[model samples]
Target: MKPEDNMNIIFVGKRHEASRVLSLNGTVAFVLAVFVAALLIATAWGGYSIAVSQVEAREPSESELVAEWKRKLDEQKEELAVLQQNVQYQVDALTLRLGEIQGRLLRLDALGQRFVESGLVASDEFDFNEPAAVGGPEDSLSADSFAAPDLTRMIDELERKMQDREQQLRLLDQVSSRQKLEDELYLEGRPITWGWLSSPYGYRSDPFTGKRTWHGGVDLAGKEGSDIISVAGGVVSYADERHGYGNLVEVDHGDGLVTRYAHCKTIKVSVGDVIQKGQVLALMGSTGRSTGPHVHFEVIRNGKSENPETYIKRASR
Candidate 1:
C-alpha cells in the first residue's frame, strides 16, 4: 500500500456532526518537528528570563554601591576622629601632669638650695644649682618607644625619689641643728683676755694661808680690771657675792654642766641673763679671800668639779 496523501476524519456526537480531511506523510512530520522546536524555544526563553531576573536581583546597583562605600568611609572617618580626639585628650592630660611634675621638681630644687644655704651640707658636695651626676650603659633595645604607661611609671619613681630626698634632707637638717646646739653648750676656754695659768687646779699652796689646800679651779692672773669672760653659751644662774668666792657669776650650760667665775671686781651679767661664749661676764680683781688681779674659773659637771685646764687646752686646740 502507498502512503496516503490525505486522510479523512468523521465525527459524530449528540450535539453535532463534522467531517474533515488532512494531508499526511512528510507534512505531518514537518508539523510535529515545528511544534517540538517551538516548545523548546519557549522553554529556553522562559528559563533565560528567570535567570536574568535572578541576576538583576543579586547584583548591587551603582547608587547602592556608592551609598555603601560612603557609609563605610563615614564610619572610618568617625572612628579616626574619635581616635584623634582621644589622643589629644591623652596628650593634654600628659601635659598637665608633666606641668605638675615640673612644679614639684622646682619646689624640690628650691628646698635643696635652701638646705645648701642653711649649711646643712657642703656646697660642692650637695650642689643644688647643678644637675646631679648620673651614668649608665647604653641600652641595646633603645629603639623601642616609651608608651604612656612607661612615662607614668617614670613620673611615679621620680616622685618617690623626691620624697625620699626630702626625708633625708629633713633628717640632715635635724642632725645639723642638734650638732650646732651641742657645740654651743660645750664649755671651753679661759675666763680672762690676758692671763697665765698662775695657779693650777688640784692640791696647791694657798696664796694667803701659806698652807696646802684643794683648788677646784685654775687661777688666771692678769692686769687688774681685766675682762673676765664666759667660756660657754648658757643662762646665768647666779651673779652675787659669796663668803669664800667674791663677786661671782655662775652659768648653767644644761645637761648638768655649769661654769663659775670668781674673784671678780665687777659682775657684768645678772641672774637669768643669757651669755654667749667669750662674752665678758666680769672684771678680774683681788676680791674675797685673796690674791690680786686673777679670775678663778671652774667647770662643774653633775655637781662635781673638773679641772678647767683640760677644757682650756681643748678649746685652744
Candidate 2:
C-alpha cells in the first residue's frame, strides 16, 4: 500500500458561503452588536474626557496667578518704600546734627584765634603740616605740595603752646601786682568831687582887677572854707610864692608829677611840712586875684604847665 495521502485541513481567509447563511448571519449579528456597544462606550468615554478637560481648563489660569504675584510685588514695593523713607529721615537728622557740631567747632576755633591775638594764648611756633626744621637757617614750604601730617605732632604742638600761655599769664599777674604796689605809694587826688570848675586855663579876664590877663591856672569854685586837700604824697616844694599865685603851696610828687594850690584863706602847711594825699592843705577863699571864693589849681609836668583838667580827670578816675 502506497502511503495514503495525508489528510490535510487547511483554512484560509475567505468570504462567507451561502449554504450556512443562518449561522453566518447569527455570528454577524453578534459581532455587529458588540461593535455597536464598543462604539457607544468609546464615544461616551471621549465625550466625558473632553468635558473634564474643559472643566479643568476653565479653572484659575496662569494669568490669575501672575496677577496675584503682581499684587504681592506691589505690597513689597510699598514696604520697601516705607523702609527707605525711614532710613532717609534718619540720615537727614544725623546730617543736621553733624552740621550743628561743625558750627560749634568753627566758633570755638574763632575764639581760639581771638585768644591768640589778645596775647592770652600763645600760637604754635611752626606749621603742623610742614616738614621738620631745626636750628639757624629759616626754611620755606613747597608751594606745590599738599601735606599730611601726624596727629601726634599737632597734639604735642598744642601742649607746648598751652604751657607757654600758662607762663605768660603768670608773668602778667606779676606785672599787675607790681603796678598796684607802685600805685599805692604814689600821691593822688579827688579832682572831680568837692568842687565845680569855674575857670579854664590860658588868657582870660582877671575877675578881681577887671583887666585882660593870661590865667596860669584853673579856678575850682567851691564854698569858702571848704576842705582843700593835698593832691599827692610829697614834701612841700614851696609854701610861700613870690607873687601872682598868692598864698600858694606847691608839693613836688616824685616821678615828674607836681601839684599847686592857691587862693587860700589860711595856709595850714608850712614850707618844710611833709604832706600826704588827702591831708588838708588850706581853706578855699578869695585870697588873691579872685572875684568869688574859689580854689586855684595847677599841675605842672616836666617843667611845662599843662592844663589842670587833664590831670584832674586822671586823678579823679
Candidate 3:
C-alpha cells in the first residue's frame, strides 16, 4: 500500500510522555468498520433477546389464559345460582303466607255474616255482604321496605290476632243463641191480637144456665174474625172442635207447659204443626159455648189449669 493512501491517527494522553499512532489502509479500515458493525449488531441482538425473555416471563400462555377465564366464569355462575336460590326461597315463603292470610280473611267474613243473620247486629250497620269501609292516610313512620322475613313475621302476628278475634266472636254467638232460645220459649202476652179481658178464671155465673160454675180459662172479647195468636213458641197438639170450647187450638210448650186458645171461627193451625210466638193460630168467633167473638185462653201446668192472667202480665225474656 502507498504511504499516502494510508490514514494515520494519534492519541495523546495526560501523564503519558509517549503518544500512540495508529495507521489504517483501505482494506484494514473496511475490515475494521465491518468488525465494529458486527459487534454493534451482536450487542443489539443480546439486548433484544433480553427484552424478549422479560416479555415472555411477564405474559401468560394461551392455555393458561383460557383456564383463568373459565375459572372466573365458574365463580360468577356459582354466585348467580346462589342469588337465584335465595330469591326463590323468599318468593315461596311469601306465597305461603299470603295464602294463609286469604283463608283467614274468608273465615272472618263468614263469621261476620253469621252475626248479621243472627240479628246480633243490624245488616245495614254491619253489612257482611259488602266490603267494610276503611280509610287511612299513608303512615310516614311505617317501613317503606320489607324483607321476606319481616313480611312473614307481620303476617304471623296478624293471623294470631285474627284467631283470637274469631274465638271471641264464636263465644258471643253461643251466648246470643242461648238468649234467643230463651226468648222464643218464654210465654207472655194475650192470645187475642185486639181484645179486652171479659171473663176471669175461677168460679163465675154462667150466662146460659145462670148458675155458679167453675171457669177453666179466661175470656178475651174482641172483634169477630180477629187474629188469635199464640202467646209462646210450641207445637200444636190439638186444633179441632172440642165439647165445650169450639175450634180449640192447644199448644204444648216444653217443660210440661201447655196453652189453649178456643172459640175461634176458623182454625188456622193443625195438629203436629210447629207454632211460634205471636203466630196467628185461628180467627175469633162465637163458636160452641162462646157468647160473642171472644177467645178463651187457658194455661195448664202438668194437666192442672192455672190463671192465664199471671202469664199474660209477665214480661217476655
In terms of TM-score, which candidate is stronger, 2 or 3? 3
Task: Give the per-residue lDDT digits (tens) of candidate 1, residues 187-288.
Answer: 776777897989899998888787999999988889998899888889999999988888889999999999999989999998999887789999888788
Deviation (Å) of 113 in candidate 3? 5.2
How does model 1 fare in lDDT?
A: 0.84
lDDT of 2 by residue, 1-317 (tens): 12332223244445644332122344455666689999999999999999999998887879999999999999999999999998778667656655765565454455455555444455675332344586775569645542223433554565566557556655765665455435533545543247888999989877777698877778898888888887667778887643656678888777787788887887888887877667888888777666777888888887878787665666531
Q: What lDDT does each candidate get?
A: 0.84, 0.69, 0.89
RMSD to the native, candidate 3? 12.1
The top-ranked prediction according to lDDT is: 3
Which structure among the candidates has the greatest TM-score? 3
Alpha-carbon TM-score of each model against the true structure: 0.49, 0.40, 0.62
Q: What is the lDDT of residue 56 in candidate 3?
A: 85
Q: What lDDT would candidate 2 get against the real structure?
A: 0.69
Judging by TM-score, tell me the better candidate of 1 and 2: 1
Which clashing pairs does model 1 show? none
Give the 10-residue window scoring lowest on summed lDDT in candidate 3: 1-10
Colliding pairs, model 3:
none
TM-score: model 1 vs. ground truth: 0.49
Best-to-worst TM-score order = 3, 1, 2
